[model samples]
Target: MRLLALEASQNSTYYISRYQQVEEFGADLCVLNGEGTEGTWPEDRYRIVGSKHIDDIIAAARAWHAQQPFDGVLTFSEASVTAVAAVAEALGLPTIGFEAARTSRNKLLMRQAHEKGGAAHPDYRFVPELEDALRAGEEWGYPLVLKPTLGAASNFVFRIDSPDEMRERFPQAVDGIKDMAWFTMEADGLDLGPHGLIVESFLDGREFLIEALAWDDEVYLGSIVDRVTVEGDTFDDDVHHAPTSLTPDEVAAVHDVVRTGAWAQGVRRSALHAEVRFHQGRPYLLEIAVRPGGGGLDHMARVSAGYSPIEAVMNVARGVRPEVDHYTPTGVHTAAMCLISRAGRIQEITVPEEVSGSSQLFFFKVTAGPGDVIKRPPHGNNILGFLGATGTSFEDAMSTATELAAQIRVEFTD
Candidate 1:
């Protein structure tokens, strides 16, 4: 199938890997970007509209479609979700609808939709300023989550344990969101609805990341991974393991909640990245992103569960129901984590042959290069890349992953 992936306001470089995956899977892929670096893709297959505005993007896409029609339109970006929906609608192609796209992209809208649809979620208040955040903190009490309305990869997300921390972090979040690539990369001239901070009641329990698909009145959990991250004030450090340890009953409960949340977000037929966390021994919907999960999650899904989220994306874009079923593990054990380090400009990153050439290694990618700034929490949740390994058990997998991670050295410019 001929597919077109849209990157409205292409602010990040990681999307190239996703586009390449489409081609590697034997699909004819083309890219349309509102704003992108020159030569990021071949001239024959890439087009830039030169403006990050919705109108310009639609016009450019319409012109391109008239010349060479695309069988499907899609995106692998949190920022471009709504833009792709708009383009697909304009071109008379299959879409999850613009309303679903908007609600999925904005946290405040998502919470409101979930509440209206009776999906279990945390109480949230949109805070536009520090004063608003302070009032929210007072009302919601301490140990609340302060996050941006339009956010991804946990950027500008903080766990406020006290009012003083709320006071200290509110201004940083306000300043950081101004330049946050996730927010800034959105196509202009759309009513994004509450483009600011939100204070949410925290869920204190284990978290699960699910790669799922939503069909007509049904949702399928393709791959389920456990978020084994050690919690901190900021949520930058993420560690994951699979096959998940959820009991069959727990998995069914998670599936029901995910289905409810997906319908609540008006996502009827699309690839979903649902994040569910527990509170008081019950699952609550954290989010339902209208795209596949990031990092080596696609690889994890294939290896650990015998499910292919990338293939699901392609199928959904073409308006075809993906071949998916309820969560079923292939009895494979793997562990993965985001490569994080202290803040600085990257000078060199070295992965020793022992780690790189190991047979247990399944996934590795260096996202940062020389001269790239690596920002940790407070500034941003910048990552070096991803590393995943397989083993006989969860402990063995995690041990191999961590040990190999330690051997991969990163040098920063002082």
Candidate 2:
């Protein structure tokens, strides 16, 4: 299959490895980006649109399609989902459709769709300003989640446990979103839905992440990982373990909720990254992204559940039904976390040979380097990268990952 991936966000370099993996999965891959560093992809297979405007992107893609027709269009970046959908429609390729893509990427639209479809979800209100946020907080009570409608990687997501907290964070989120990388990198002139903050009643229970597929009337949970991060005021730190510790009945419950959410969001056929958290013993849909879960989730899924989300992406992009099943474990235990550090410019990061070459290590990638500024909480949720480890059990894996992570030193300069 010949696939053309769209990434107008200018963050295309981060997914070079994924593009290579797609090629390794037996498909010819070409990338079209709005802006990207040279040498990120093979010159012959990569092109820059040189513009984030939808018209310019479509024109470039159309010209490329004429030279050699692409079988499908796809993207792993959240910021490019809508653009990919547009290109796919323009080129007469398989797609989840523009409306579905838009709703899935915008939290407010997703919530409205879910509500209309009667899917279980948190109470939410779009807060376009501080006054609206204060009003929402007054109505929802304390401990509400404040987040951007078009956010990824947990930027500016906060938990407001009191009026003072809400007052303090409201402006930060409002101003911070104006310059957020995810929002800024989006294609120009696209109807991106509401560009504001949403206050959602917090889900006070265990959370789980799934790499799923929705085909026709059926939605398959290909891989399920538990979000085992400890409770906190801000939703920055991410820690996960797989296969999930949920009972069979609970797993089934999650699947049902996710199915409702997919159909609700108008996602009939697509690769999904669904998040559900329990509230009062019932699962509530957090989100159903049109892409797979981020970080080392792909690795966790492959090692623990024997499911390949990347392969699913490839199959689904061409209007083919990916081979997926209900969540089942391969008995491999693994733990992964986002490596966090103090806010400053990174001078150096040192990883010992023992940690780098450990048998228990399954995945390790450092995203930050010299001169890269790391922003922690309140400012931004920047990270060093991701690290995942495998062992006989969850505890063993967590221990190995945490211990090794501590040994890797990071020097920061203000």
Candidate 3:
């Protein structure tokens, strides 16, 4: 099979793993990337210059397909999913369609679709201006959340506790929206005109993620991952563990809600990443992305569930249903911790022998070495590295990973 992959960065481990998986499946890969980002992939590279508009991308893809005649068009990156969907549809290939891809990226559209499809979601209002946001705050009450209509990695997401706080932080949130728009415009040439925000009631509950593979409108549950974030901080993710602490019944409940939300967004053949909050024995859909979860989620799934997310995605691209039934629980726990640091130039990184000697330590990687600049939070690229581990139990795995993370400290210059 000849597969056309759009926008796989050479520097990203996730993309590298994906490329390796495709080759492992004995497929020829062709990559399409933005102009300057060309030649990053080792496969047959095609360039789409300024204005990565959907029509332009499709046109370029059509020309490439005419010669090479690719069997599939696929992308794992969130920014390129919509473009891939359009190209796939244009080429008469299987995909989730353009509308579902658009709904997955736009929070406002997603909420509307979920509500219309009978999926429970938080009360939300689209605010085009500051005054509208203030009005929404009043109507939605305090402790609301403000975020961009189209965003990822919790960028520019703020939790407002009161009207006063909302007033004070409204400008910052607007700035975030503008920054996000500028990024999309530069990266994908996607002109997201003006700035808009979504204010929604904060759902107070335990957070969980459901990873699934969808085929023929049937969603197969892969694994339930419990998301651990810094308490009181809206953007900081501490860790993610697979085979969540939730009981079998609770997992089933979350699965039902996730299935509803996935179908509501028209996910037919894709990797589904759905986030839900469990409160008072009820599951509420938070958000859904038509891609696999990042931050070593694929590794977690493989370790705990005996299935590889990357392989599942590759199967989808190859016009085949993923072998979901082959996944069986291994009775082991896996966790991934994000190595974060403050803004500064790294002087040295110290990894203690105790941490390196631990039997539970699966792997440790430091992205920012000595002399590398590390930006603080709220910055788009802030992850210093990642640490992954496995244990007999979730608590043991998380505790060991946390202790190992604490030992490896980055010393910044004065």
Candidate 4:
């Protein structure tokens, strides 16, 4: 089988892992990378920044298919999901449909679709201007969450407690939209139109991520990941631990909510990433993505389970049902932590030998080095590196990972 991957990045360890898994399945991999990412994959390669134009992507795919037909068209990145779905539809291949892909990228559309499908979601309003946002504030009341309709990594996500705070922070939020618009405009079909924001009623609760694969309209529940976020002023992810701390019954309820959200988005065959908030014994859908979760999520899944989500997604792309036994705990716990640093030029980073040599350590990757400038949150790409570990229990795994993460000293220049 020949697989055509859209927008494969060499910088991603996850992408490289998935490529290796595909080859392990005896499938020939052909990558269509973005503008400067040409030499990432040594195999058959094509260059077309898929986000720039769907037609160009389809044209390139068609030309490639003429020589050797591709058995599957897929992508794992959030940026390229819609484009890949468009190409798959053009080729009469399996996909979640362009509408679903569009909805997945836009939070406003996602909330509307979920509500229409009888899936519980927060009350939201599409804010196209400051007036609209103010109106939404009046209707939704205080302590609302304001974010871009299409955004990732919690960039520009603000929690407005009152109209006064909204007035003060509204400009910054609008600026974020402008910054994001620069990229969204270049992406062929993803235009936010003037100004766009989603004001949602804030739900107070614990958050969890649902990782699953859907095939033949049946959702296979994978591990439910417990997400830890930075407290105060930002919603950036701090750590992820799996299998979840949720009880069996709670996990099942989360799974049902995920299934409903996935089906509502018309996701028949794809890797599903759903974020939900549990409040008062009820799970409310936060958002869903038709791509695999990032930050070594697949790695944690492999450590906690016996199978890889990357492999399962590949199987789904090839129209094969993934052999998955959901929520079957492996008697051990796994955790992944992001290496965050203060904003400045990195001078030196030291990882303790003891921590590095530990058997519990799964992998440690550093993306920043000397002279590399580090920015803080709202930039959404502030992570300096990542660390993963496994232990006899969730507490043990989390403690080990947290301690190891603390041992890595990152010195920044004055």
> Which candidate achieves the best TM-score against the true structure?
2
In the range 1-414, model 1's lDDT, one tens digit per residue, is: 989999888755787888888889878999989999889888999999999899999999999889998989999988999999999999999999999999999999999999999899998998877888788878878899999999899998999998899999999999999999899889998888888999999999999999999999899999999999888998864689999988999899999999999999999999999999999989999999999999999999999999888989998998989889888899989999889888999899998899889899889888888899988889999989999999999899999999999998889888
The TM-score between candidate 3 and the true structure equals 0.88
Model 4 accuracy (lDDT, Cα): 0.75
> Worst ten-residue run, lDDT, model 2?
8-17
Report the backbone clash tally of model 1: 0
Residue by residue across 174-219, what tens digits does model 4's lDDT show?
A: 7766665224532364442324678888888889876788776577
Taking every candidate in turn, the Cα RMSD to the unseen true structure, in Å, is 1.2, 1.0, 3.2, 2.8
> Candidate 3 — which pairs collide?
none
TM-score of each: 0.98, 0.98, 0.88, 0.90
lDDT of 4 at 210: 68
Per-residue alpha-carbon lDDT of model 3 for 1-414, expressed as tens digits?
A: 888887522233346556666778777877776433545567345454444666666777788888878888887777667767777898887778878887877788888889999888899988877788789877777788888877776767778887787777777767665666324632353333323788888888889876787777567778778887755636556688877778878777877778788888877788887889876668899898988876677777777887677777777876888778523577888888889878888899898888777778665656667877765434443567778899878788888888789888778895
Worst 10 residues of 4 by lDDT: 185-194
Model 1 ranges with Cα > 4 A deviation:
none
- Model 1 scores worst on lDDT over the 10 consecutive residues at 9-18
lDDT of 2: 0.90
lDDT of each: 0.91, 0.90, 0.74, 0.75
lDDT of 2 by residue, 1-414 (tens): 999988986673578778888999999999999876777788999998778899899999999999999999989899999999999999999999999999999999999999999899999999877888888878778889999999999899999998899899989888889999999888997999989999999999999999999999899999999999986888864689998999999999999999999999999999999999999999999999999887888888999998999989999999998888888899999999899888999989999999889888888888888998888778888898889999999999999999989998998786
- Residue 202 Cα positional deviation in candidate 3, in Å, after optimal superposition: 1.2
Flag regions of model 2 displaced more than 4 Å. Answer: none
